[model samples]
Target: MDAVKQHQQEEYQQFIKDKIPKPNLLRNAVAAFVVGGLICDVGQFISNFGQSYFNLNKDDTSAFTAIVLVFLGALLTGLGIYDQIGRFAGAGSVVPITGFANSIVSPAMEFKREGYVLGVGAKMFIIAGPVLVYGFSSSVALGILYLLFSI
Candidate 1:
């Protein structure tokens, strides 16, 4: 019985290995570029639509579009649809601010189940905190330098 079980396990492993596709570096690089470009293209499309429909200037249109995408991404993340889309689109789904919102909320939601203090609360900002910190710090530093240089 033990020998049969071991043989079956080995065969199953072999079958899985054989069925899996081998990685191709060129294919992966091309796929990543295409998906990333597509994501940016979609964002541009949204921005353009907002600009035309609402008569918003470039900055306002961009802000509005970003807000809309972020809201939609968060909603999709809540509905559990974003994960499937992420899997399908790979870098395409991950290249936007929407993806950032999803990344921040998804892990937080999972950690919430582990308890608030140590789990959800602690881990909630694990992904996004660094981004926020860097963004804020860089902006502040740039502003200070600009002020000093302008004087």
Candidate 2:
């Protein structure tokens, strides 16, 4: 009886697997590349505008560009457009600061109804906290390594 049940389960699993659609790897890769490239292009444009029009230095211009991108990402997320873009672009949407903005805003939006302090504030960092932790840790480690090597 147990053997018969196991055989039935295996057949059901195989049936489900066969029913699932296969992904188009090449197309997905191309879409990700194009979306990612477009995001970089927008950042470049913002940086250029900051430099040419506002006369910002390179460092300041980059900061300005990052701010703009983050703002745009948050705005689009609020408007419900960023998720659509993410669905289409996949990892392309996730590889930029815009994605970081989305990650921060998305959970906050989701948990807002639970209350501000306990919900939005608490959940806002669910995705970004670990990233910040590791990012800072890695940078500090690399800085120390650089100092040691320099010495």
Candidate 3:
């Protein structure tokens, strides 16, 4: 009986392997690279504009660029275009601040029906909350390590 069950499982696994198409690694990598590059190019353009037009210093220009990217990400997510882009670009759409914006806005929109305090506000951080928590925690830990080492 156990042998028969094992044989059946093996057959099912083989069937699944045959039915599922293999992903094209090179093509997917190229797509991700192109999308990520385009996003970075936009950030650079914004930074350049801030420096040239607004006379912002390097640090300020960088901050401005990030703000612009975050805003664009949230806007695209709100308009539902970011999800499509994310589907196509995969990690390319996700490794930037725009992805973070989408993370926050997507849940907020989903829970908006629940009301401001209970729905949108409470659930807004569901996806990104853990990420934020770990990010801050790690940064603080690293800072403390640095302080201790430097002393």
The TM-scores, one per candidate, come to 0.69, 0.86, 0.87
**Residue ranges of candidate 1 with Cα displaced over 4 Å:** 1-23, 88-91, 114-121
Q: Which rank order by TM-score, best down to worst? A: 3, 2, 1
Candidate 3 per-residue lDDT, tens place, 9-119, comes to 999998899789888888878888999899999998999999999999988998999999999999999999999999888888888889999999999999999999999
RMSD of each: 8.0, 2.9, 2.4
Model 1: pairs clashing at backbone N, Cα or C within 3 Å: none
Q: Per-residue lDDT for 22-47 in model 2, tens only?
A: 89889889989999999999999999
| Model 3 TM-score, 2 decimals | 0.87
Error of 3 at 102 (Å): 0.7
* Each model's lDDT: 0.83, 0.95, 0.93
Give model 2's TM-score versus the native structure: 0.86
State how far residue 91 of model 1 sits from its true place (Å).
4.1
User: What is the Cα-based lDDT of residue 136 in candidate 3?
Assistant: 100
Q: Write candidate 1's Cα lDDT for 1-151 as tens digits.
A: 6999999999999989978888776766676677667767777888989988889997898798888878878898999998987876676677678889898889888898789899988898898888889999999999999999999
